[model samples]
Target chain A: MDRGKISKWLKYPEKMGHKYSLWAIYFATGCGIMEIPPVLTSRWDAERFGVLPAATPRQANLFLITGYVSVKTLRPIVRTYELMREPKYTVGFGSCPINGGMYWDSYNTIKRVDKYIPIDGWIAGCMPRPESIFIAVTKLWMMIDKGAATGYIRYRENYRYYRENQERILGKLDWPPLYPEKMGEDNG
Target chain B: MDERELELFFGPQHMGMVGNFSITLKVRGDRVVEARANPGYLHRGFAKMMEYRVWIQNFPLVCRINVMDPDPYELIYAMGVEELAGIEVPERAKYIRTIVMELSRLASHLAWIWAYGNALGFDTIGQWSMGDRDYIIDLLEFLTGGRIYHIYIWPGGVRRDLPDGFEEKTLKILDTLEGHLPEYDDVFFNNRLFVTRARGVAKITKEEAIELGATGQVLRATGVKMDIRKLEPYAAYPYLDFEIPVREDGDSYSRMMLIREEMDQSISIIRQCFKKMPKGPVYHRVPNPFKWKVPKGETYVRMESARGELGLYMVSTGEDKPYRVHFRPPSLPHGILILEKLLKGASIADVGHIMMSLYIAAPEVDR
Candidate 1:
């Protein structure tokens, strides 16, 4: 959060014509979690884009599952999606969350997270370049600004398995520290 | 003294681990009595993956085995297939390959620097080092559209030639980096606080390091002048002039210093390769990836990676895909015996420090 970068970002909102403030982004699943740093940093600066990753479900409306989501992680992803208030959005990065790109055949990884949750935007690539991620962010911002039906609200209608099998999916294998925890947990 | 000592598991899920791997340590109070390195946490079956894909297809996948420094995998696999096919890469491509490889070395060293600095509670240096590494990654992306896994180095040569003004751009970046090195030195290298924490933390004699099969920085840290770059000149290394960096401290501080020195050497190597680079085709057309079949032969190529000596041994059964491919990762020695010994008498907080100093990359260990 350098002062120079912050000032530049401050000017981008009015120039880009965005309406949302205090937008919250989430990384519930995938290798895209690796990109969370730069994605949140001043360059990509999700905040300046008017979308900040919220620390809690009570504060967020956007869930950006940037990479792959294994079955073990799907439960948490589903839970996080459900906890967010209405008018929520979801963006999937890389082919992983959409169709399990390289690990499609793996028994552990889910083929299409979309099948489980509604997706607002899809950035395609084995692992989408950071630039593509940026594009996806802009697309997501436009969709949100328009007040369109982006992410799903009915958890029972979609991701029934995720809702039903929470313990089995999320509880298995003691998720690594790198795995995102429920909001308020110290990630470090 | 009573019956025994305290035991602690360093990871598979522990914060101390470099990636997903872990180690179990047995300690008598602060002094370690026994230690064992345990791997295989995030093993994606890389060996089996190689068996399923064609020789060319395996290039990208193989690089993941050592994500920190992937160019060696590119060079190793390329050298093996080139040997099998009896093909000689163009002179210019060879120099280009060396330049890219050395740049990869610099990137890898930067990553280690970041992790090591963070491990010692020096978070600012880690951030600074990582931000600097982004510049190298940007340059790599410019050269070969791919950043992390540059599958550009194929069987015969690179996928494409240096882009327009690639040399000038690279030289400019190098100059910028040269200017920044003094600042980095003031913060991490010459900083008194870092020196105290890292000094005498993990030590091994030259004989012990050799006996334990240490290589690269760990081996060099033990006063061994063994570097794959010096012993085996792959690509255009024969034409380049560089020295293998060695240190006598045999401790974590020395290992850290070794990488710092190595970064300078890598910069020098890249500069030499750029100057001596001849003009010619950047790539020699190889048989189509779909129709390619290597001659029945076995070849082993080793490269001095940021982690250590990464060796790729390929056995071709006269098929499009390799019959057998074995990766001898340096993490094995560093991860196992050397790391196990280093943990002795150190606090649990220093677990990550010991691992970083030894340069035990997890994928390399699992692969």
Candidate 2:
């Protein structure tokens, strides 16, 4: 019971909507996806925490980067991340996403996930238990309350910097830019 | 006649498709005209990676091949190694492996039900099936330390013996699952809407199904009585008595029905394992991981996984690490050939429904 969030909840119902109804776009990457069914099912019951899988990225605010991101997968990942609405949060769900985990030396997989996507939190394990996902979600709620979970905002503010880094690896990205820096107009 | 052709990139991210893979669908109006599969998004090239790791280190890597049903991949890989090394799994270890495999089959079927129901816009059954699958995953967590990837089945035998009072707990979970069958029948299996949507949606002939290299439930549903468990007995399958559920409809409904009945069969098999299990050592220690070198030989071991026949082809050249490791996933033909052919005349609404009904675990395709 953080007093700040409690007070803010009363003041801003908008924040309450973001806190309670966090729709996660299940942008599955690798093996860690096995844990999601159990989490969403009756046993783990992630719905109890108001987290559900959104079919499309446009409707979701929480992007769950489930496992290792290979060089090829980062293209869709960035596109999906950009499609997500503002006040968004991203969580890297397994050890693979945090630091490439077992695939550290694998030529295709990216060793550091944070370099490309602005991840608000990480659940570290070869594959973290379903319960650990709940913990990450609660921490995300706290960050949202404090207005600290600003990965989306950060993505918008420094689109050029992030875009350059993304383009460094993924040359001539297929999709149009999420925010055009050349227009000199703040999309944020 | 007025319908226009639309080139749709039914890529990896869509709800209907399985895993991190894509399908390039050419559709005119609601029906698909031509389809091409774009796979390997989840491809870490695990086979090449296996060559670099030692025999024991590769055990965990095999499970990553099929995310939905990792047990059979681990089992087949272990069986391949066991055959290549001339290692014998003990009686108790074989029984334990059988029990774990059957439990995995149950969980995998439940997941298939969840996917199928969700694909057909029946979220109620999806939630229910997922709830039931969790019960099986809980038992898995109890047996192996890990929930998703057990990595328990190794060359010589299993990792360890069953934990204390594991049998009794397993019985209770089975009882609970048995109780939930009627509710599933009402909401999903026997539900009129599901039957209407699934039946005749993606029908395949028996000859083409076999010709196209489809196996497991997909092949079985096409009226072909082919099951690796029945035809080729491995592990404790010879001792255990279970019937393979086959349906002749060769449509989405038949496949769905076989999956439901197979879950019941898996449950029955687990009960049989519990009744017939014997007490003995679960493992026979091999030489140190680094020093253990398999004899020079090539072996092909195939096991019936949740989807179908999961085969592993291993080439060991008297080396500490395998020279070549190849996986024959049941989902390959089901995903690419069967799925693409099945999708050609299927309405756009049935794209995901038909694919889910086929039960192609996409990770296996890429791996």
lDDT by residue for model 2 (A9-56), tens:
689889889988889887677778778877887677888999988989
How would you encode candidate 2's per-residue C-alpha lDDT over B127-149 as one tens digit per residue?
A: 78888888788899899988788
Docking band of candidate 1: incorrect
TM-score of 1: 0.78
- Candidate 2 residue runs with Cα over 4 Å from true position: A1-7, A182-188
Indicate which candidate wins on TM-score: 2
Instruction: Point out the worst 10-residue segment of candidate 1 chain B by lDDT.
Output: B11-20
Q: Assess the local accuracy of residue B364 in candidate 2 as a C-alpha lDDT between 0 and 100.
A: 84
User: What ranges in model 1 sit over 4 Å off?
Assistant: A1-93, A105-123, A131-160, A163-188, B1-18, B24-36
Local error of candidate 1 at residue B14 (angstroms)? 5.6
Whole-model lDDT per candidate: 0.73, 0.85
Q: Estimate each model's TM-score.
A: 0.78, 0.95
Looking at candidate 2 chain A, the ten consecutive residues that score lowest on lDDT are A179-188
Docking class of 2: medium
User: For candidate 1, lDDT tens digit of each residue in A1-188?
Assistant: 56775564566654233335535544324435444544554345556566665656667776777666656456556656766766666778777777777665555666777766778778887546667766766666566445553456433333334332454544542433222333234322
